[model samples]
Target: MVAEEAEVLVVGAGLAGLRCAGVVAAAGRDVRVWEAGDEVGGRIRTDVVDGFRCDRGFQVLNPAYPELARSVDIANLRLQHFGAGVGVRREDDAVILAHPLRRPTRVPGMLAKRAVRPSDVVALVRWAYPALRPSALTANTGGDTTLLAALDDAGLRGELRRVVDRFLAGVLLDDGGSTSNAFALLLVRMFALGVPALPAAGMQALPRQLAGRLGDRVSTTRRVVEVSRDSAGWRVTAEDGAVARARHVVVATDTRAAAALAGTDPVPTHGVVTDWWASDREWPGPPMLFVDGRSGSRGPVVNTAVISAAAPTYAPAGRHLVQASALWGPGRPEPAETQMRAHAAEILGVDAGGWQPVIRHVVRDALPAQPPPLRTRRPNRAGAGLWVCGDHRDTASIQGALVSGRRTGAAVLRALG
Candidate 1:
């Protein structure tokens, strides 16, 4: 049949695509977003089952996310901050890293109680350098360079591998090997900007708000089959034989999808598994915990969060919710659910026997595994009238996705002008 026409055709209704559509439409341009799933948010999805609200994966927002805080109205959304310092659980020891906001008197006690070795604390302080300086941290090459190389020297490597890497792996879900040293610096920048924030309702609320703001410009359940250029502009064919033509098009899906639509082959993307537990305990609140699970018996379990305490609406009153995640190496066998429960129980200091986790989510292609001096990132513009945007294009995170979308949108706008 005939193809629909618009000034801009955005594929993927995730945060990036929706954001692009919103910005373009707000600028008085005709923009339409095509979403493959029946829902709007891509990976950032939430489900309500049996009076419980659960996100596909536990996600948090750093107040420092430039795109979200600056472009989107986050204040209107329900948000809660994790207290300053993150809590850590290693074997029998449980400790809380106090945020700088704590009273000076309490800071020492908290650190001491948490059993934070003086050297570990010192290493943490040193690592905070790049984060404190916005200009230095955001430098284009800052994220691409290796942290090890930047701090190449004696003692530092030992400290990083022993203390810093362990802690970071617990938080970021991947060892520093899969990410850039700049990525760590960015987290520090986020902490320096403001505490990590979570939506009171659920993670999906953020994307839903963005989609709602876009009005009738979004089309859900429209899977994009192909993206190619024609003499007039760009032609985007959906799975159902429907076509959309636009002067500009943005592919904002995940990396695999983006590659497929652009007629490129798929590359290896490291996978990770996340488990969410909801029960009767009180969630300890945000600054959620990040344990250095590298030393644990079960293998590398990084980046665990106590989400319910971070936000009130995640669970029913008096009930707590916790999300524990771990990244598996390529070709590694998936861990059994029983094993995950045991690990969670040991980490959280609770008897997980009766506390059933309602949700289990596994992202086989969570994010790309980029080594230091990260490579494999594609450009935003694939052709004259077509563009690409997603977390995979740069750093891997919600903020990265938003920034990529904004950048692609700006580029498309400029090209049109």
Candidate 2:
């Protein structure tokens, strides 16, 4: 109703803020969402530049996220699924790891690769078979170890280890593969459910759908810079002098931003650089993520793939869009543009000179590092009248952001009662 007083105010129009606001509004509360940027989705942005749809950072939506149903409209997104599995590029040949159930016909092709020896295939089956059972999950109690340590203890070595290593490195963004086992298991469960995909319109479609449902409740281009309490309830003032008062304020910003607002320490993070390219030719076959068999040491690009092949909207008519990504720690120099292009060509066995550069995004705080002693969900309540939710407070992924938002929404509802 465009009232200055909202029962609940959400400071961030990204996934977390939108999801929380959606839940609050559905609960019959008047909630307002304020965003600093003109566009929603935060890091999950997609821009059409020179006929190429460039996603700000490399991201994928795991339809298997438990909280996904609560936040996003699955069927409405029109997701474009990636191929059943990934392709690992060895020296001369590419090894395909097709999901046995989804692509039964591709089983023979996967087995033909030298990397997938008979024993490795059996080991993969032994691991994958029982994992399908939800009951197979072991409780995440106190002690935890790195993913590399777990793989080694399980006796995964050589080509099999390298294949899994490269794949996890790409997905986890753990350059040294040191993320905690519990968190990695959570990710494994999500990945095992089905192939990840992009929205037919772009990644923005997910948040767009959430915001569309919110309608005019969201105020874009209004930055909520300060949250203070007077004798009244609470007041949130934007840098532009715009103000809104609410009983409760949810700070669904990034870890750093949230920490800055709350005067707390920011969560440690890992940086990632994604380079976008457009080419006249499409990549070889079905849409698949290509990972380096040599464990990222051979090149700056740990993985490269044609996103347009998986989601046609990523490129204009007859053009192809490719993405290559590398991860680094904070304060480290990002991989240069030339290094990324050359490394991508080396990994994909393509001509780097031909593909034109679309854009390069070096995100210093791309993801929260999931080191040992990990807690899947951090605190959602910043204080009695304030709250926070984002990847920083959750599992450090789009799924985490959604889940945290939904959780905080419930908390706010309970507080109101």
Candidate 3:
């Protein structure tokens, strides 16, 4: 086959790749993207099964993300926002701890449930105050510590602790609270500022929207296996033997793939297994993510949500869609279908006996682990001709991926000039 020539070639069609290509193309540079997967969006994919839309992994798009708002057309996504709160499942009942300001009417009911203590509430405010300021993370002035330590230091040990810890674990996919305190606080700040939502179509819509802007520049089913320096610039070869020669190359794949192609060390990643179910009955509770708050209840599921309640388009007209997410760890395996169903039922306070299994997605590298002393930006320029960018290169989030991509694209442009 004749070798394809590209002025700039980007490997992987995830958010980073699409964003980088967009930047380069916007600058009037010839850029092309090759995605190994059958579709764009990388891990942010959705599968249609029996008329239900099941995202590869449970994910939400936060409009508060600066890069997201700047890059994508948020209105087009048709976002269905979740309630600004979390449902904590206790031994006997489930209580929703909503934002006092956003859901003022619910606050009286929440306080009546005694779901949170005044002291715990005070501690939470103190711990989250610094995170609310974007300057804190930008300047990296405050000393960092583990999330657990920070919470302890703030004296947040109460029912609120259990609820918040599990809720965050589901979001970060880190059950042990080993994530950076600063990072966790930043996430909390986002939650405070914006309500995350699912697109009317699904989470994959975000990347699809990005890829659509590139027109024919994005190519899927092109699993890149090699990237080596050549006289002109670099050569990218796919497993199918197709070759692309470019003046600049960007490794914009996942952490392991990017590290392998860029000759850099791979960062640790956290995995998650999400089970999707379709039930004829709907959950009566408000559309919010639920976490186990019952003391010492060590079930496989970290969080469960009535996805259809939040986004009706995800399910058929009469059916409801539910998602149960569990962390994938060392020696930990996917739970049996029955166990997941039972736990989800318990969490939702509904009968899941008849709920039909739709799909179970096991993503081994769902997220690059973010540890303490948070470093938002990692080295992106790997060599003279090769560069790297991903969520791993910046913060581990949609925001990070877009920022890294734009930064890498600018670097490539500068190199070519």
Best by TM-score: 3
Candidate 3 on 28-92: residue-level lDDT in tens?
99999999999999889999998999999899988889888888999999999998989888888
Per-candidate clashes come to: 4, 0, 0
For model 2, the superposed segments whose C-alpha errors exceed 4 Å read: 1-3, 100-109, 122-138
Which pairs clash in the backbone of model 3? none
Cα RMSD for predicted model 1: 3.1
Q: What is the lDDT, from 0 to 100, of the residue 284 in candidate 3?
A: 78
Candidate 1's TM-score? 0.88
> For model 2, what is the alpha-carbon lDDT of residue 364?
74
lDDT of 1 by residue, 270-290 (tens): 677778777786544344665
TM-score of 2: 0.93
Model 3 C-alpha lDDT versus the unseen true structure: 0.89
Candidate-wise lDDT, in order: 0.70, 0.80, 0.89
Candidate 2 lDDT over 1-417, as tens digits, reads: 233799999989889999999999999999999999999887778888897877777888888888887777799989898887777778786666776545657667766745466676665555445345534333443556787776766666667778777778878887677887667766776776767989888889888999998899998898878888866788888988888889999998878888867655688887788999989986775688888786436877878888888989889989899899998775557888889888888767777678998998877777888887667667787777889998888788888889888999999999999
Stretches of candidate 1 above 4 Å error? 99-107, 110-114, 138-163, 176-178, 263-268, 282-287, 290-300, 374-378
Tell me how far the alpha carbon of residue 148 in candidate 1 is from the true structure, in angstroms, after superposition: 5.5
